[model samples]
Target: MNSIIYGPVPSWRLGRSLGVDLLCAPGKTCSFDCVYCQLGRTTSATTERREFVSMARLTEELKEVRGINADYVTFSGTGEPTIASNLGQAIDLARSILHLPIAVLTNSSLISREDVRGDLAKADVVVAKLDAHSQELLRQVNRPMAGLMLSDIIAGIKLFKSKFTGKLCLQIMFIEANKNFAVEIAQVASCLLPDELQLNTPLRPCPVKPLPPPQMASIKGNFHNFRNVVTVYEAPRPEVKPLNLQETLRRRPKL
Candidate 1:
């Protein structure tokens, strides 16, 4: 059977993270085709939600990783984890089976829907991606599905933050396109009131080159008002070996 669970992949933010892919479909399925995506451009881009992996299968996979040394069981893979309709159920199952703190990394595309917000609320930590502040920048950077507006996304995040008791971290990916607009994106992130702010760029192999440490430091300065801030360049990367190297690379290449 194709593995729905992969990694103990090393992460700067989550330490040794075990990844769970609900949408284990052919190629990458995502709502946004980000310019700096390491898995390359999005193969399938849509806003509709559906059940791709069954709970039974996820339970079986979770059982295999019960003793794995992972800091968090992350709901992320080749696609957006929020697009999975049964995400809340999956989180519950993973938590019950593995007893690890659940984390979900979202592109903040489908959060406008109340169902999606409810699903995301199950996680212990939600790393919401907010790369652009304006509609034009949204198009240039995120290239989201049709009818996805910047204003609606921001409002959705705000609403989710208001009710979520768990940690809400805002992740801002800075590149040449949006480097100069750090202050603008920072202003927007500040309004959302994220518990932690993560400034990141494309350090992995991708179409875009990662900005040097100096540039990233300059960008971090824009958010000096924020108490907790972390940058990709300065973060620690722990040593890890995946249970299945092939499976891990299938989801996150160059791991």
Candidate 2:
């Protein structure tokens, strides 16, 4: 059987990360079909939250990797993890079973929802995405589902930051489309007062090419006020051997 738990995969920010996919559905079931998504286009773009994977199944998978060597057990897979209605329970269960820090990667589309915010609050680290500074750019880059406004998303992040005591890292994926808006995005990141700020480009194989390191360096300059700013080009990735190479590549494929 295919397991919901995969990887001790190398991560530039989180090191050797173990993945927990609550929504392990076929194709990319994201809320945003990003122009630079490595997983390709979004197959399902709805904002409805439901249980895609059962607790028993996730529990069984977690038991198999109880003592697995990993830096963090991440909630990310086939889609926006926040869309999983049982995310809070899954995070708690993963922590209790694996005894590892829980991290969640989310496209901020659903962050504005109270229930989604509640679910994400259970994580030790929440890497929230902020790719665009305006609604127009948001449509061009993130291509978020309808009804998701940029203003509301920003407001939601600030609200979550106010209540969340954990590490709230704002991850900005810079593409040719949004590179010039770095300062505007940086201004919002500053207002949210995230624990860390990540400057990323599409380094993986995708439709768009990554911004050169020199350009990314100039973008980083806009975020000079941030205490913990990590650029994708500068970050070091820890070497890791996945217990299931096939499964790891299914989600995070080789470049």
Candidate 3:
């Protein structure tokens, strides 16, 4: 059987995160073509939400994860999770079978849509992206889909904040393109008022050279307007390393 899931990858913020690929394959589809995307650019940037994978199959795969130790069961792959038409169904299935908290790492592109918001409302944690404050920088860094606009994205986040009872973390990826607008970005983040604000820089090589880590003191001083703040950088993870072929097979014996 083809594995639609990958990685109990060590994350700097979330401990061991088990990832679910809602896209067709590992690197096949996505909504945005971000400049600093660790997985590189999107091969296809479609906004339409559809059932890319069968709910029954995803449910069976999730049952297997119950035996694995994971801090979070994440809805993230090479693409956007909210674009999966069956996302709400998948979340329900995973919740029923697994004890781990459900987390969705999204670009916040479609959260403005009521249906998307309704789908994500079921998750335990929603980490939405807000790397750019202005429309110009948003286009430069995120390179969002043809019709998506910055206002729409921000509006969606605000809407999600109004309704979602779960934890909301605003993930800001600080690249050179948006570094100068950090204060403006903070102001925007203050408006959304998420539960936590996670500031991060690129950990891997990007289409362009990523920005040096923002001065922690300086960023904190500027973005202190947000109620709760947490900053993450491209720091070394001493406890974690990429799993080799043998170790990977060992972890998933059935594979």
Report the C-alpha lDDT of model 1 over 51-78, residue by residue, as the tens digit. 9999988888899889889999999897
Preferred candidate (lDDT higher): 1 or 2: 1
Cα-based lDDT for every prediction? 0.91, 0.89, 0.77
Backbone-clash count (model 3): 0
lDDT of 3 by residue, 98-189 (tens): 77788998989998899999999999999999988888888888888788899999998998899889999999887677777888898899
Q: What is the lDDT of candidate 3?
A: 0.77
The list of candidate 3 runs beyond 4 A from truth reads: 214-217, 234-255
Please give the lDDT score for candidate 2. 0.89
lDDT of 2 by residue, 128-183 (tens): 99998889999999998888899999999999999998999999999999999998
Our tally of clashes for model 2 stands at 0
Residue 54 shift from truth in candidate 1, angstroms: 0.7
Candidate 2 — which residues are off by over 4 angstroms?
253-255
Model 1 TM-score, 2 decimals: 0.98
- What TM-score would you give candidate 2 relative to the actual structure? 0.97
